[model samples]
Target: MPSPFPITLFAAPNTLCQTLTLTHERELSALKKAHSTELQTLVARIENTSLSTPNISTTSRTSRDLKRKREEKPDQDRAS
Candidate 1:
């Protein structure tokens, strides 16, 4: 039975090296493309989730302003 992976018996060392290098390059390219696709899919999912969800901010500007005013009132009274 013929081997699934057949290297030409007459192929020179340099030729064999070049063939292996080319095969590795093709495999690397394929892996990079797959990784990029997965990353893009994850980003799209995250964007969709964010869009569907409401902003749950820790503190709103209005609330922060009110808190700051309340805090500064004591300083103002002390200064008077």
Candidate 2:
């Protein structure tokens, strides 16, 4: 006579494994939501700072000057 109880016992570990996997997936989803919220808050803070400050053009002007210098310099190694 084959015992059916051994089959049930073998299946119990698979059930436990599925439950733990679901718990971990839920925890990861929660952490991802929290991080997204934090990133949004930081971005909003940066935007507010940029709007409030008046003298932030110095950095932009430097980059523009560098671009102009590159554009004015002719290609010296061109083979005509």
Candidate 3:
């Protein structure tokens, strides 16, 4: 079966305004269809990229520092 894509054919010049208008509309429709497919592809890529990334959440520097310091400190008293 022939593909749905438009075929390039040479035709005599269309003199009627209505014929030219119809041709222009058809071309625009085909162009819109192509852009729609491209947009869908981009959207899928964006979705996949977002899904593949790690979800790790990071605390602020001060909170991380506090947590590390707390871990390093011991219960033993330093004073005599």
Candidate of highest TM-score: 1
In model 1, the worst 10-residue window by lDDT is 53-62
Q: Is candidate 2 or candidate 3 better by TM-score?
A: 2
Q: Which stretches of candidate 3 lie over 4 Å from their true place?
A: 1-15, 56-80
User: Could you give candidate 3's per-residue lDDT for residues 1-80 as a string of tens digits?
Assistant: 88799776466456466678999999999999999999999999999997887544533666788887887675334432
Task: Give the local distance difference test score of model 1.
Answer: 0.91
List lDDT for all candidates, in order: 0.91, 0.85, 0.79
Model 3 earns a TM-score of 0.52
Instruction: Give lDDT tens digits, candidate 2, residues 22-60.
Output: 999999999999999999999999999988886658878
**Model 2 scores what on Cα lDDT?**
0.85
**lDDT, candidate 1, 33-58, per-residue tens:** 99999999999999999988766673
Give the distance in Å from residue 73's predicted Cα in candidate 2 to where it truly belongs.
Answer: 38
- Deviation from native of the Cα of residue 29 in model 2, angstroms: 0.3
lDDT measured at residue 79 in model 3 versus the true structure, 0 to 100: 33
